[model samples]
Structure formats: C-alpha cells, structure tokens
Target: MIGSSTGPLTPSRVLIVDLPGPDLTPDQGRLLRQSGFGGVCLFARNFSTEKRTARLVSDIRDALGPHALIATDQEGGAVLRRLDVPMPPSPLALGVLDSEDAAREAGRIAARGLLDLGINWNFAPCLDVNVNTANPVIGERSFGHDPETVARLGVAWALGSEEAGVMASVKHFPGHGDTSQDSHLTLPTVDKPRSELERTEWLPFRRAVQAGVGSVMTAHILYPALDPDAPATLSPAVLSGLLRLDWGYDGVIVTDATDMHAIADRYPAGAAAPLALSAGADTVLSCGHGDMETHTDHRQALLSALREGRLSEARVHGACARLDRAVNRFPGVPAPYTADQRSLDTAQVQRWAEQALTWVGIPPRLDPALPLLLIAPISAPVGGPYGDSLSGAHLATLLKEIYPHLHTVLHDDHDPTAALSLLDRFPGIPVLLATTGRWSLTELPRFLASRLRKEQRSALHLVLWNADQAAELKLPSLISHGFRPANLQALAQALMALR
Candidate 1:
C-alpha cells in the first residue's frame, strides 16, 4: 500500500494508545490533536457507566475525528470491558452451542453494543483452537479444540461484526491456544513442527484470511517452527513471509500490547516499536503505564526510528497505509449504530448461552432438596487479561440471578480456613465450586472440593469458563465456557431441568 499514493509516515497513524482514566483531559485532547493519532484501546477502567462512556467517546471524537478508530477487547465472554451492555456468550460458549447463526448473532450483538459507545473495532473472534486445556490464558477465549470448527465460527463472528459496521479482528495469530503459559507474564513458545502447526495453530488463521478478515493481531509467543529467534510480534518470517507472502493476507497486522512482560521485560518501547513495524506489523499496541506520555514516548520512538534510519521509510508508509485503509473500511460513527438497546436481543443471546452448558462424565444431577453452598476463589486482580477478576461482584450477581436461594463463601487459597469453616455450617449440602472457569484455576476450589468430599458432603463443579478442561479435575463438572450472567443462567437452568 506504500507503493506510490499513500500519506506520509506518522507515529499517531500506527499507534493505538490506552488512556489512564475514563475522561480525556484538555491537555490529552491537545496532545491527541497535535499528534493526529490513529486510535484508542478502551479498558475496564474506561467504563463506569453508559453516560460517562458516551461523554468520553464524544470528547475522543472531537479531539481526533469521526473516522479515528476506537477499539477494545469486547470479546464477549471472559474479557468484556463494558457492563452496561450485556454481552452474548463467549467464543467457546458459541462453539459449544455449535450454531453458526448464534455465533454470528453474538458478534452482531457485541458490535452493536460497541458501536453504541462509538467504538469501531472489536479485537475479537479469537481464532485459536483450544488444544491444550492446561493453557491458562486462552481457554474459553478460544472457540474449540478443532481447527476447522474454530475457523468456521470465527469467520461467522467476524462477518457478523463487519456487517454490523464495526470491524472484527481475529487475534493472537498464528495461535496462542496450545501454549501452557500466559504471554502477558512471560515469553511462551509453541514448540511444534511446521506440519503440526499447519494442522493445528495455523488452520483457523488461514481460514480467517480467506474469509476476508480485515486485520490480524500477532502473538508475542515464539514459534521456533517458523522463526528461530524472535517472537511472532517481531518476526518477519511469521508476519511478512508466512502471513503476507505465503498466505496472501493483505490486511492490517497489529501487535499484541508491547507493555506485556513478554515484550516489555525484554525490549524497551523505542526498540520494540520499530522492530514490530519493521517485521510487518501495521500497528503497534503500546498501552504504556496508564499515562498520556506513555503514548507520547511510543510516538517519539517511531519518529526517532525513522530519523535514525533504524526503520525503513517505505515500511512506515506501508504500515500507516494499511491502518488507514482499515479505518476507512470500518469507520466509527458519531453516535449509536443501533437505534434501541433492545436491538441486542438479550433473550435470543441467553438461549444460545443456555445451550452451551456442557458436562464432563456423568451429569451431576444433585438433589434439589440439598442445601447448596457456592464456593469461589478470591485473589487480587492480575494485571493482564484472563485473570482473577471474575469471582467478584459480577460473578455473584449472575450466580444470584440463576440460583436465588444459593449461599456463597468466597475464599482465598492462602487462607482457606475461613471458607472451609463456613462450609461446615452447610453440613451435607452440595458444594458448587465456581471458578473464573480456568481463569481462577487455583488450588483453592480443588482443595475445598476435596475437603468437602472427604467430609462425605457432595461436591459438584459449575465452572464458568473453559468447559474443555473440566474433565481434568475428575469431578462431575459443568462448563459454561462463558463467564457472563447469561452463561451461568444456562448452567443453572440445565441442572434445574435435569431434576
């Protein structure tokens, strides 16, 4: 795209920054206008209420432009940032439902909600096939274990969002599902042969490119099968040679957040910024330590690289051109794309979620007469995505909606004495250990479940995400594969009807 007729290279055009707070200050607005920035990535801190979110978007649009891309990880399951708009079941839940129609509708629902908040990009339809149940980060974020299934549903979801006027991007490309570790914590490697990767990790992404997905986000993990040295985010073979040349993918390539320890601990903002762009990434996600100057540093990093000749001028132009094309293709509107909030079809979404409840081994049809005590893990929130946040008030409200009469004991694994002692009050009641599914896969619930079983009290697991791994615990478990209230509603409804 940098061939002959593209705009001049600029830092703002290729950087999607994260803000410190929900409100954009006057100084920040001035900086944005001056930089002529490309986009903003919203986080959980950005949305306290719909009114405030609307005002934030209004100010952002005023500072940047109507066409400036607004993106967020509203992937509709575990990683939903906005509570005001009810999201449909997660990707894995949709996969379990096995309905292309539902998956597409879910995407449409997610896009419409984001569009209402003036966001144009949904960094979603995680194309990773969840082959490894031990994987801490990917789990329910992925579609399923089957590559083709993931591809089919991912394409459906992508089209649903794109057709709704918000662009959907398939992410953590070349795959993050097989890795046992979280890339946010450290560098992870997918050590498999190229042939093995072809059948597994590469299949869904290849299908996404064929389906005309407008963008692909690179994983920070190393793929020694593809490149011996750098991770996918900074590997030319993975990005340019494999994705662009061999696969013929002509979409914008985005890097995972450079702030993550996988990259940040290794490379500085200035170095990683140029390296990522040079490696064929069209945009660098540099969500610096929650400040305007973090973005300012990254902007200067790219400009400095250009001045220093560390990065090619043509490469910068090309990246900017690809990003601009994507922006033009899926521009953010000034106001809500859908007329009414009812357009989200909450009932229909719930129906799909209901069908996603899956069982491992025999269905633990606990007697409805048994007193139920819900035991959940509690811990400080982890810094990156897919962490310990799900066991909080959101989980409680949803669990309450489904099982009104249920009692709960929130426990930290460090001191299970408080929770275990509470469990004694229930006597012979069945214990429902709710996890952030695998996100809260600490020993707390397992230990408590073992303790309950030892006491001859019945124990059943109602995992809120990653049903694929429920079999690992050898407990009669139900996996919703989604963390939303709708997901819990489905699991509760299934168990209730079973009796």
Candidate 2:
C-alpha cells in the first residue's frame, strides 16, 4: 500500500487517524501507509490484551516501517491506556502523598508497562493547572493545585519515563485547567491575565520543558490575552512565540485531537489540518472515525495547501525531524511477554495505595455500638471514553469489603433532594462518610457546602477518587486519594482515629 508516490503525498506533512482497537485491519493499515501518515495514538479501548496489543504495535511498525511513530495516552489512575494490564496510581494520588520519589517510581512502573507492550510514546504527566474544580475534563489527570507541586511531580514523572525508555509528552500546552467546560465538547476560554498564567498555568509546562519532556500537546481552548481570534492549537502566538521561543521547547509540539468539537466546530474540516500545521504544531491528531469524506478532504486540503505555498515544506520537514529525533532517542523496546514479579504482586500496590490514602481527612471514630452511614453516589462525570460512574461502583465495592455491616446509602449527585434526605436521616452520627463521586468541592453546588457546614457538628468524611475534582476542591476534609481498592483500609483507620 505504501509504494513510491511522486504525487502530493509526503510523510512529513501527514499524521492522521486513531483506530478503534489494537487489531488493525489490513485495509486500515494499508490506507494509513498510503496516506503518508507519520503516527498513531492508542487508547485503552484499542487494547484488550497485552500480547495482542504488542502484536498490533509490531504490525504497525512493519506496515509503516521506522518512519511511523506510535503513541498512547497512558497517564495512570483513571486514564490508563493498556486495559489488559494493571496501571499505577494517578498523578494526584502521587501529589497527595507529597513524595516525588513515589511519582518517579510510578513513572518507572508505567514506562516499563508501556515498553513491555511495545508502546514507545506516552501522553502523560499533564502540565495543566487544576484551578477549576468544575472542569469536566482535566480534574484528576492533573497533578495538584500548586504550580510548584505539579512542576516537581511532572519532572519526576518525566525523568522516570525517560529512565524506562519511554518518551513522555506533557500536554494541553498553555494549560487546559481552570476551565469548567470540556474542550472535547466545546471551546473553553481561560480569562486569566498573563501574569496569573505565568505563575500558575505555565509553571508546570516550564518545568516539563526543563525536564526535557519529548513532546508538548497544544490545547484547543482560546485565551483572549494571547490570541483573540484562534484557539491555542491554531494560534501562532501560543506555539511559536510562547512555547517555542519563550520556553525554548525544542521538542515535538503536537495538537490535541483535531476531531474534538473545540476545533471541528470552529473551522471547516478541509482547512483545520493545514491551519494547525501552519500554526506551528508538528503533528495533528485525528481521533475519531467519522466520515471517509472528511478524511479524504483533509488530506487533499493539506496537500493542496503545501502546493499553493500556504503550508511550508520546511515546516513539515522540521516537525518530522523532531518526531524522528524523539523516536531515535527513545526507540521502541520489544514487548516483554512475561510480567515482572515485583509489579504483578498486589501487596506492593496496596502499600502504595495505603501511603497515598493518608492525604485524605478522616472524621474521629464514633462509638462502635452506633451504626455508621456511608453515602455513595451512583454515577460521576469523567473525561475521555470512561465516565466517573464506573469508579464510584468500584469504591462502593471497596467500602463494602471494609465495613460489611455499615448502612450504605446510594444517591445521584444530580438529585439535591436525595442528598438532603440522606443528611436528614443521619444527623450527628459520629461517622458520616460521603462519597462526593468525581465531583470536587468547587464543582459541588454552594448549597451543598452550606448544608455540609450546617452539619459541621457531625463528623463528615470526604473522599476524592477523581483527580480533577479532588484537585479543584483542595478540601480541608479530604481523607484519601488513591486508585486501589485496598485504600479503603486507610480510610477506615482514619475514621477510627476520629473517634
């Protein structure tokens, strides 16, 4: 399929398409090769088994050869890419533990996991500032609130990634945090002043650049101060002036999924690809499989743009060179079919989870004779393909394991009456464990705060399993932050201590 072509096809200018799964059809592989695409980004849904995923990556390499780069969004916690294998705790969990060393270890674990699966690039260690709790997208994916904390953890993550021979990409450049809306659905605006941005939003990115992160992905959000007209992905001021010139980030600069509503809604499909490349992004990530017409149109448009002198050949070559350099620097390590004994054991995972759970606040233990009330939410909002709802069920299972006899109340955060009724039923109960679900304190209604404060006399325990919401709340009552089911023991210990 990828025979020599004298026409408009060029490898440097084209990076297209994300398949639905690890098993790529021969036709799909052929199409990619013929289109002159330079890479593919993998997600959890794309992988069902590690061995199959490894074979898939190998197949892709054979089809596209050395020029094709393989990447995945494998940041741990809820955003794990390899669904077949176990993933480490999320960045916020590491942040809560306040241990850079742990973060580094997580990075090593994650990197090793990726390498074992033949994945060379990981879109990880999000550099966004989690200032907005109501933000639908980047809650738990972010490290923490303080820019310094994010920067420190991000550096550790990057170092750990490099140590394990995986290229790390610090993403949503210019920051995706501080926005309440999801960029995948709409173009969110960040109205912060340049000074505020420098202090908070840009801090972690600066650290990532210094840490030698191999890539930086641009956000689709618009910043009026930086570019009044275009989103960061299409803004020359953001990519060239700030990221490249000011920050001196010589690494590959990639655009987030071009198919997202943030970009798709704003520009014509034919125009988006060329505009993104001209704006300074070396690669454009096309996420979904929508219409064949759209793909063909974009490809032709890019080729046409290059021929007409709208998109420079030099720019495309420069981008390709950066990507090639990154690939060569961190070449793919063949998959290790055998699992490492240390990583597969659940004890180490439980230990890490227990240590991370310490950051959460636990109410004093009440009389053992009194029945304890555990309020759990049925569903929660989440980013990517997975929603926050699944994690809630997982937590419920964990809680049941710890306190089999405890009276458990389930409610939907959407229903105010449900929460009120639960509150009324459990007045002055020494131990009231409320699962805020994935929603953070900031995302919660002000009425909920008033209600919680009114019942302040009652020992209230809050646990944030979602990173985005947890980082947003910065809740004084936060009791635990981890991804493992065993973290419930720490929560139980903290609750008992309250008594």
Candidate 3:
C-alpha cells in the first residue's frame, strides 16, 4: 500500500533514501520502483569497488527511473564510501598544505572518481570548521580550525566538483564543529551567542551560499541562538528564515539522515519527515531503513499531513520542483577516470601529504634496517548503521611491503597489557600510533603513551586524524592529520627519511 494511491506527485518523491546493500536485490528494486524517491544515497555498505558501484548505480537508475539523482558522502577524508580507489587526502591535509588550486584539483579528482561510478551528487568539502578539540565527528574532515580557511578551500572544492559536472553540497549548516558530541549518537547543542556565531560558525556557510552551492545539508544539533525549541533540521528559523529568506539559498535544502539518533531519539521518522518539510527542508534523507516497509511509514506520514492540512500542497510541489531542477542541472554521468589520470592524482596526493606532515619536538631515532613494532589503538565500532571499527583488511599488508622489518598491530585501546606484551616480544622501540577519533580514546591509550616516555625508552608517537591527541601525548610525535592509505604511505616514507 506504499504506492497504492497516486496523487499529482507522490509523497515519497521528496524522500532521499538508502537501501541495505551493494547490489539491488529484486525486492529492493521493487521497493525503489514503488517508492520513486528523488535520489539514492550510497553508503560504504553499497560501494566497495568502482565497477560494482557503477553496476549498482545503473540498477538504481533502472529501478528509480532514468533521471534519479545519486549521491554519497565521498568526502575523501574519514568518510569516503569508496573502499578501494585513488582518492584525495583529508580536507585538513589540504588546508595544511594551504593551496587553493590544489584544493580545487582535489575536488575534481574526487568528483571524477564518483562520476565514473555513476554518482551525480557529492556531499563533500565538509564546511564544519574544527575549532574545538573535543569534537568527535568533524576533526580532520574539516579543512581547518579557522573559518576563513574553511570558507576559502570549501568554495574552491565546490567549484571544482561543479567543473567536473557533479553537484556539491556544503554540509552541517550553522555548523557542527564546536559541539563536543556526535549527532549520530545523540543530540548536540552549539550554545554560542549570536555575535560569536556570526564571526565564526556562520562564515563558511555564508560563503558557500554566495558561491552558489547546489544544496545545503542541515545539522541535527540545536542552536539556542537560532532556535531554542528545535534543532536546525526541524527549526523554521534555521532553515526557512536564516537559510532561505535571509541568506537567499534558493537551492535544495536537504536534511541530514533523520534516522540518526539526534533526530530519531526525539522525533519518529514518520513525524520528522513531514515536520522537516514543513520547517523548510526540501528533501528528507533516510539512510537507516531496515527495509522498504520502514520507508513506507515516512510516505504514509507525509500523505497524512497533506490530507490533514498539516503540510500544504504547495510545499510538496515546491520540494518536487526543486528536486526536478537539480536533476536537470546535475544529471548523472558515468564518465570513467583514465589510468594516467589515476597515477597523476595519486602522486599529487602523496606530494601533499609529504608537504603537510610535520614533527613535534625531537624525532625518535630508529634503524630503517631494524625490526619496528607499530602499536596503533583503534576502538570498537559505534553500532547500528554507522557502526565502524576501522580496519581495511589490506592496511597491514600494504604497510608490510613499505616499512622494512615492520610489525603493525591494531590493538583495542582498553588493553594496555596486550600492548606491553606486543612490545616485549618485538624488542624494538615501538611507534605508538593513535589513529582513532578522540571520543574513542581510552585512559589506557593515554597511559601507554605516557608510560613509554616515562621508561626513558625513545618512541615515535604518530597521531593521525586527531592532532589534539598529539599534544596530550607530549613530544617526539608525527602528525599526519589523516590515516588513509596514501597518508600511511607518506608517513612511512617520511619516517625513513629521518636521519
């Protein structure tokens, strides 16, 4: 009964949704056909390889219709959906390198990779400025700690993506950077006063709008200065008043997955979908749907709202019209990246990593010819849809080839005993690397770093993706600002170069 009655426009058309896996199963195809969503957002679960992603996107087009828009986070930093491919470095790395041209090139490279995969939209250039050290989600994903730097590089990236025929969306509007909590887990509050927000948080978003970004995704966090009662997604002041009316962002305003705990724990999807649209969001993104039936609830609610006058006919039509405009503006193009282009892009990223990488205090001495024990602390995966315990299966294999006499082990941060055991057996000055997010850091990991230094044993503390943790680890640390394969390769080469 999800598609039982057809109006001039289906209620589901305003929904941007995601299915369960990589390929489109027959049932999923039927669901896509029945739902007729405006777009499909791909997750790491769906995209592993370019060929597979292209095939899956082709299948989605068939099911959702030829003109259906496809998008992914594909941010190239911590949130890349493509498991294996030549991708650009983190925004922080680019920011540290401090070249607007290179930032633009990185954008084009990432977009072209997605274009080859049949994805038309990229939710990238995470505009969230990483000013707060305790912020868990938007660390290296952000371009820098400064708003001006974020605005400059973010706009450049958006234009680069546009240059390659891909739509770019600047995200977490109003800003999710200063907040300490992750919205995926719970509701976060950015309680800054209006004056401070105007100077800091609002600058990049303002720049993005002036630059004509095709879409803007709203954060789930509550901004008391903007709207006290509701988070940005459900607040009319944030979406309609601030974004649409004042800022003049005529493009589509998409909500970050409402199924995330920030919105989910408070408002049910059925209620949130209609509420978001009424609040001014043109598209409601739902990614955690278990199956077609869950999506059906959102459709039913919107239909109910329309019937009850809770949602106006004009609003539904307006959203559909905007979606149609985006489809026309940024159509899907399955253009492939050539072999030569891949090689050049990879080398460019490697060069950036080499340039941006820096050392703290005296460098730890190690023999390139001697055995090396690398102790990396990675935490348990955050459960549910975004559940992730970062292990690439091939990382160890890749490191083994590059670092001579290298023994890399990704141990749970909670167990220092296991780390000590590994150190005892290896009989080498360990390279203590913390590659996980700050939220996942345990007391034990901090203790291990302190203990290694206290023993007067020379150790190299390598902090990737979180530089704030590097300061806490004291001196003799190397900061990569990211942990992608390219970042790791650059780290290895840099370590070997130390005299």
Highest TM-score: which candidate? 3
What global local distance difference test value does model 3 have? 0.80
Tens-place lDDT per residue, model 1, 1-499, is 2221264556667788888888998988898778877788888888768889888888887887764778888887777887667676778878877778888988888888888878888888799889987787887788889998998898899989888888888989999999888888899999999999999999989988998888899999999989989999999999999999999999989888988889988987546888898899988887864767778778888888888988888887777777767877887774454435554477777777777667765655555554567777653345467533466455656656556667877766557887777786767767677665455456766677677657766667766655654654557777776666677677667777755
Per-model TM values vs. the true structure = 0.90, 0.85, 0.92
Which is the winner by TM-score between candidate 1 and candidate 2? 1
The TM-score that candidate 1 achieves is 0.90
Q: How many backbone clashes does candidate 1 have?
A: 0
RMSD (Cα, Å) for all candidates, in order, is: 3.0, 3.9, 3.2
Tens digit of per-residue lDDT, candidate 2, span 361-410: 43355554566656656655555534323445655666555555456566
Pick by lDDT: 1 or 3, better one: 3
Ranking by lDDT: 3, 1, 2
Q: Say which prediction, candidate 2 or candidate 3, comes out ahead on TM-score.
A: 3
Q: What lDDT does each candidate get?
A: 0.78, 0.71, 0.80
Among residues 3 or more apart in sequence or in different chains, the pairs in candidate 1 whose N, CA or C atoms overlap within 3 Å are none
Q: What number of backbone clashes does candidate 2 have, counting pairs of residues 3 or more apart or in separate chains?
A: 13
lDDT of 3 by residue, 133-249 (tens): 888888878899999999999889988997887899898898989988989889999999989998888999999999898999999999999899899999999999999999999
What is candidate 2's TM-score against the reference? 0.85
